[model samples]
Target: MVTRIEWLDAGLELLATEGAPAITIERLTDQLGVTKGSYYHHFGSAGGFKAALMEYFEAQFTTRLIDTIDAENAKPRAKLEHLLRLVLADPDNAALEIAVRAWALQDPDVRATQERVDAARTAYLKELCRGVGADVDPDRYAQLLYLILIGAEQVLPPIGRAELREIYNLTLRLID
Candidate 1:
């Protein structure tokens, strides 16, 4: 039997594969091979389902990226580099980002959440820049790094893990 978490996961998969327009309660229920009653048991309505999805995405980001970066043993530089590598390594993240961006265009709540995520990521990067004693403003460097990382997701070819590590190392040297 599928759990509520499973339904949310399926929703994300559907969004990633078919785009936001394709994710309706009916479609999701059909895809999950469950009835509308089952979906409603988990989420009260279509809006409720979307709200849950946004929350789910936020939690996933928190667990997968935010918490990882905040580990007590990880240095600031290591955190920043790990963030870059994680973003680059995830095959689905680029698409997920694109989908969320599209959703944000229509939903104020989503736009706010997106901004919050960007802010959190930027704050972390700024701390890393400060730790490294970079001459430029940490916030500015953080925004620059954020743009570069997003650009890499959109424009760069698939990079091997070792190659990405090398690139991150070289980029850090430039910043410092």
Candidate 2:
């Protein structure tokens, strides 16, 4: 039997490749090599499945962004750079984020969830900036950095390790 987390991961994979509109109970079950009944056993409906996706995203961002940044070992600058590196390294995440932004245009719930996650990410970035003694408004810097990071995902071609490190370094300087 597929666990809820497994189902959600499959859903996100489908969303990343085929886009949100392609996600349906039948498609999910087919992708999972299960029956519609199995799908329903885990998620009562398409909305439930989508909600699970959103929850997964929230948990992922919280773990990677909030919890990772709050680690006791890293300094403020290191934490901020680590956050950017994490974002740059995850192509799956970048694709899912692009998919989610598109889905948010039509789905209010998705939009709300995306906004909530964005707010949390921004807040964390802001705190990092303050910790580094940037002498700028944290929210403003956060917003600017967030936009740049998202835009970088689009404009810059997919990068390798060295290129990603360069971009992270540039981001740190930009915000600093």
CA-only RMSD, every prediction: 2.5, 2.2
lDDT (Cα, tens digit) per residue for candidate 1, span 50-167: 8899889877864458787776587677777777777667667767877887888898988888887777777777877788666777778778777765665555574444665576
The local lDDT score (0 to 100) that residue 171 gets in candidate 2 is 57
Model 2 segments more than 4 A misplaced: 156-165, 174-176
lDDT of 2 at 111: 97
Put down candidate 2 lDDT per residue, 53-74, tens digits, no spaces. Answer: 9989788755556786687588
Question: Model 1 — which ten-residue stretch has the worst lDDT?
Answer: 152-161
The lDDT of each candidate is: 0.77, 0.78
Looking at candidate 1, what is the lDDT of residue 119? 79
lDDT score, candidate 1: 0.77
